[model samples]
Target: MKRTQNEKILQIQNHTLVVGIDVGKDSHYARAFDNRGIELAKLLRFSNTAQGYEALDEWMRMIMEQKAKTEAIVGFEPTGHYWFTLGDHLQGKGHRLGIVNPFHVKCTRELDDNSPTKNDRKDPKTIAMLVKDGRFRDVYIPADLYSELREAVSERERLQGQLIALSNQIHRWLDIRFPEFITVFKDWGGKTAQATLKNFPTPARVMAAGAAGVLQVWQKHLQRSSLKKAERLVRAAEKSIGRTAGSEAAEAALANLLAQYDMIAGQRQRIEQLMQELLLRVPNAGKLLEIRGIGMVTAAVIISEIGDIRRFQDPRQILKMAGLSLKENSSGKHRGKTTINKRGRRRLREGLFQVMIPMLAINAEFRAMHQKNLTRLVNPLNKMQSVIALCGKLVRVIYAILTKGCLYDAEKMTNDMKRSMKAA
Candidate 1:
């Protein structure tokens, strides 16, 4: 939320105690500093537990009291998953938390003592200085519905990955056991195809069952399947050049893969359902769904990442947070090509691009804007560049919808496109 260096620097005033903590998985080392970056206390080592959190709170309080400070602003690098518990503990104790980038800590460690060597003591001082200089980002932990939504999205992704792996294994089984399986069924995941796979896994079994038996299996689960298709399947199986060895094990492997696929697919559906419910609970999230490209899950994910949109004062901040902000590597004479700086949330950036491609095809306003960007008379952008530009534009629109409670207007977007084109 503290977007400017001045604002961050201002947070560390005369009455503020800056505590730099070197967070670890088991034990953590902390060093306290005053507003002037002067050491306020001896290094304190504490275990990562409830009692340890209490001790940390007491240590900060004792330092604040001893130094005549009123507030404590704790700073630490987000070292993997170790800092989450500590951050939560600090926040609950009514202390402000600042997350310094690990890269910043690594770069700035050598400034003092001119030694690149890093230890617990050296890293704490480096972290504190970075916090004092306002070179840190705010640590945001989504709460309640937003937290639930984020967790659901994460779980869905995990399950989806498993599902993809299962699908690949199933295809691999088919490719080896029955190479001609795809000739009859282009996709083996369809209802009829799945039923056929369930009943007759190999070409030998398919040939044994014949067209009539295959049709019976398909019609058992599904309302109807083509007799002609069944006949084609039998014919393909008869001349199949698939592997004849290990037929039994291969069929069992297919069975296991199919079972795992069904389970993971079901889990993904449940997570999506939970995401939808949570999205509706989040304020102004339904409005996000009104946009053409953002579906229930995508809207939930965007809202989860942005979390309490009022924290951001501008749409550009959202773009930057999503790592869609443009950066260049130019020197005095050498003008370099500009591209997005992927220095922020990776999931948000990936989600935006993933959604944008489908949005270009489905969303009328975005589609038109993309075409205009490509065919513009001056400095026309290519396809990817246009998508990047559109992602930024979309951030502006999303920000407006969340902050101003405005509905997405296709006509207004079209007019804005025309004006932008004219200006270009």
Candidate 2:
């Protein structure tokens, strides 16, 4: 549930004990405080294990019992994956958890002692104070299908990064060994190109194999014959300016690169297949795929990043999460321009931005919106701004579709825009 600052502050009363934990890789430091920002107990040091979690829980219970508090709220910095296990443990143990931004912790460290010195002991008190003042955000841990989807998406991204690195390495290898290889095959990822690279990577190897040999190698993998393409490859190899000194090492290197590329490619394909299956478990995810430009991958990425759309009270929250919400810098006579915060999930923001190009080209409603944003009568947005605005609009559309279980409605969207413009 969403809460205002006052409401959040109200959650901490005299009977409530606030615990702040500075999470770490192995051991964590924690401090206990009451609603009045007074220290209630000595700092507790615990390890990142079941026993450590039990010790921390016991310490909190002891503090609460001693201070005559009935409820407890645990706040900590979401410091990478280190906090996940602790968060899950605390939530499983029925303690309410809140996440304090690491940036906020850094910025607010001077509030108490006015010193910039950072220690494990000093951080927990700051976190607890932020929770007391309602400056912390409630943490949302994805569970069940959402958890599976998040893992799948993360795995896909990791595989993609590996694939890119392998491709770059192969490109570097080709540049050094067979400079003309790319000229014959525009993309080395093609079946014929991959087959040729795997079987005969060097220009000398290709020349030795001859055109017919390369074509036979391709035929083993591909159904159709590319005789003309094979001829071009052989001709390019015959007059290639590639290095000839280290033929043996070059061949071995290319072979290893091809093997790694193939493995990563196969893994990516399998991960994508798994992601498609996982998408089916999400409620109303298919509605997103029903849109013209929104594919299964984009829908899966959005759903994975956003988790349950119901957790958001409105589309604005999703917009904020994507960091697409506008921020203004205006004061008195000196009014500055407004821009996006860019403080949210970067991958989610990138996905939204990337999906917009195809969406603008394919979806008439989105195309019209983009054009209007560019040429509207009052305060037209630039191309980039229009794209960002469309990204937010896409978030709203996805949120509404997921929450309401409705299909994309171009006419209704146009009508709503018209009503908004008229009201403006």
What are the candidates' C-alpha RMSDs? 1.4, 1.6
lDDT of 2 by residue, 4-28 (tens): 7887888889998999999999999
Can you write out model 1's per-residue Cα lDDT over 25-47, one digit (the tens) per residue? 99999999988889988999999
Candidate 1 wrongly placed segments (more than 4 Å): none
Per-residue lDDT value at 55 in model 2: 97
What is the alpha-carbon lDDT for the whole of candidate 1? 0.87
Clashes counted in candidate 2 amount to 0
Q: How far is candidate 1 from the true structure (C-alpha RMSD, Å)?
A: 1.4
The candidate maximizing lDDT is: 2
lDDT for residue 271 in candidate 1, whole number 0-100: 85
Candidate 2, residue 99: lDDT: 88
Predicted structure 2, TM vs. truth:
0.96
Q: Scored by CA lDDT, what does every candidate get?
A: 0.87, 0.88
How do the predictions measure up, each by TM-score? 0.97, 0.96
Lowest lDDT sum, 10 consecutive residues, model 1, at 142-151
